[model samples]
Target: MREIFEAELQQLGDGLVDMSRLVESAIGRAGTALLEADHQLAQDVIASDHEIDRLERELDERCVHLLAQQAPVATDLRIVITALRISATLERMGDLARHVAEVARGRYPGQAVAPAARDTFVRMHDAAVHVAGRTTELLQTRDVHLAAEVEKDDDALDALHQETFAAMLAPGWTGTPQETIDVTLLGRYYERFGDHAVSVARRITFLVTGDFDSEHAPSHRAEV
Candidate 1:
């Protein structure tokens, strides 16, 4: 029974890695779709979100089964609970990617970001994609150092997010109302994407070191 339980735990970890990979791909493609305004690619990203949601449900069900049957204690219990949280975070990350794709799809045949904001969006995209990729690697390897790198990437994303807002509010800004809205939403999507990625990283850190700081807790909602 102990061996079987251990195997189930391993399976849970594998499930998280799988979810991370899907999220990485989703964000990468979503960024491309946003930058190039590729309708088909955007549609593909939106459609693939269902699979991420499905995986989250399946993982949560398995977690519940383990809790009911195995009655995990101490570290094992923590692992199961953390897995549930990470799965939810990955699902949200996937949703953020889909949101980016949705914006691209909504503005099909025309670029989503205006010319003045395109460069900032491009930087945001690159940082988001990098964070997503690092998140996948962090889950796969459980390297605590990788978690620090993820935090750094999140910082870059935050800076770019601020840059987007500054550009939009500048005196010489000339973007139409629609363009301004699109850019605002797009910046938020990428910024939130980075936040979710950081959440995942911090969770992994807690799992590894058995330490958590409430002050630095993950942000799930947008800051006003």
Candidate 2:
């Protein structure tokens, strides 16, 4: 019975790794779709989000079953509960990627980001993608150091998000109202994407160290 329970725990960890990989792919493709105006790719990213959702539901069900049947205690209990939380966070990250793709799809033939803010959006995209990749690595390796790198990547994304607002407020800004709206929304989508990634990182860090940094709690509200 103990061996079987241990195997179940391993399966839960593997499920998280799988979900993180899907999220990483979603954001990378979504960024490409946004920059290149590839309507087909945007549609693909939107469709793939369902798989992430399905995985989350399935993983959560497994966690619940383990809790009911195995009655995990102490560290084992923490593992199951943390898996549930991490799966939920990954699902939200997947949703943010889909939202980015949705914006791209809404704009269709025209690019979502305006010419002046294109460079900033590009940097945001790169940072977001980097953070997503790091998140996947962190989940797989459980290396707390990778969590710190994820935080740094999110900081870069935050700075780029601010740059978008500064461009819109500049005296020489020439974007139409519609363009301004697109820039604002896209910047927010990318910023929120990074925020969710940070949440995942902090959660993994907590699981590894068995200690939550009061300054960097796993709560998304605290991070945002």
Candidate 3:
């Protein structure tokens, strides 16, 4: 019974890693679709959201089964609960990626971002990708160094988001109202993506320290 329980736990970890990969790919491809104006790529990203959803459901069910059958205690219970929270965070990240893709699709042949703000968006996209990638690594390794790196990556995204808004407010800006709105929404989407990654990093911190007082504790709580 213990052996079977351990196997389920391992499988749950693998599922989370897979889910992280899907989110990373979604953000990267969605950014490409937005920047390059690729309608087909945008459509592909939009359609792939369902897979992320499916994985989240599967992982959640596995956690439930483990809790019901094994009745994990102490650190084991913490692990299972954290897995549920992490899965939910990954799922939300996937949704943000899909939202970015939707912006690209909405613009169709035309690019969602205006030429002037393209560089800013590129920086934001790169930071988002880096954070997501680091988040995946942190989940697998539980390395505090990676967790710190994720926080740094999120800082970069925040800075880039501010710059994005600053550029829009500049007197030299010439983009239409529609383009301005697109830039605003896209900036928010990318920023929110980084925020979700940061949340996962915090969960890992909670896992390591078992400190519920951490800033992320409120969001990471599980009924069990």
TM-score of each: 0.96, 0.95, 0.93
What is the C-alpha local distance difference test score of candidate 1?
Answer: 0.91
Greater-TM-score candidate between 1 and 3: 1
Candidate number with greatest lDDT: 1
lDDT of 1 at 96: 92
What do the candidate models score in CA lDDT, each in turn? Answer: 0.91, 0.90, 0.89
TM-score of 1: 0.96
Mind giving the per-residue lDDT tens digits that candidate 3 earns over 55-144? 999999999999999999989999999999999999999999999999999998888898889999988888988998998898888786
Model 3 alpha-carbon drift over 4 Å, by segment: 215-224
TM-score of 3: 0.93
Clashes of 1: 0
Measured by TM-score, the strongest candidate is 1
What TM-score does model 2 achieve against the real structure? 0.95
Which prediction has more favorable lDDT, 1 or 3? 1
Give per-residue CA lDDT, model 2, range 48-158, as digits (tens). Answer: 999999999999999999999999899889889989998998998899899989999998899888899999988998999899999999989999899899989988998
* Error at 89, model 2, angstroms: 0.9
How should the candidates be ordered by TM-score, best one leading?
1, 2, 3
